[model samples]
Target: MPGLGVCLALAASAAAPPVFVPVERFTLAWTHSIEKVRWEEDYAVVASPTAGQPPVLQARTARVRGSGAGMEPPDDAVLRNGWYEYTPRMGSPQGLRLTRSPYTADYAWCVDGQCVPLGQWLPSDGGVTLLTPCARPPAPER
Candidate 1:
């Protein structure tokens, strides 16, 4: 019975709540404008102000797992410059500025009125680049 108690303790500690801490901030510049960015934990958002268009806002959410300090381009990424790179894992919210949430070890794009359940990280499951995010299908205004 004492051995069983030890196993339970170990499992409980292994599943500690995710530790969320802001790791870094980078600006995303584009032809039309730039975006101010900051992300951690379950959310990543990019905001851009256009000349005549409503400011673009892309918000993404995921179930956080673990935290890390930084990110490196995936094996198949194309290096554009010191701060810019391209990876096949790009998602709908493509942007020039890219980041993998340090607070999210595993993730999924949260979409649909009923959010998708957590799933494995897809190679094409990253956040927006330094550009536009996935636009919604037009729906009739109520």
Candidate 2:
């Protein structure tokens, strides 16, 4: 990594270096362009089971406000506080790749109740922005 941060990184393109972040967990929030329903998926930085392997991103939970065709929450989702919340059964992925555009609502990385657009980290230019868990090295001793 080119920065002094941990857990996750977002790269503007395949040729670009990833922007390391000090986040252990964050929620990816967005609204469907067609249905206009809000969806949020919670994720965490998970360490690799094998030694010396880099960490990965894991889906922890999910929630959606309102439902429509193709936007229904899982069967186990519970309606709580106007949002259907549930634990996503999708297995852990190595990283998340998000494509951004002016035609659709931007994705937000929410942490501590603050949600910032992914564009803040990298401007969209019709390319994919990759978010992946990064292995932060131990701080060097002075």
The CA lDDT at 67 in model 1 is 20
Clashes of each: 11, 0
Q: Could you tell me the lDDT of residue 137 within candidate 2? A: 54
Q: Residue by residue across 14-121, what tens digits does model 2's lDDT show? A: 555556677778889999888988999998876677776787678999999999997799999999999999999876886777877789878987888899987777
**lDDT value, candidate 2, whole model:** 0.77
Query: For candidate 1, what is the TM-score?
Result: 0.21
TM-score of each: 0.21, 0.83
RMSD of each: 19.4, 3.6
Instruction: Report the CA-based lDDT of candidate 1 relative to the real structure.
Output: 0.27
Quote the lDDT for 84 in model 2. Answer: 97
Displacement of the residue 4 alpha carbon in candidate 2, Å:
9.6
Which segments of candidate 2 are over 4 A away from where they belong? Answer: 1-12, 137-142
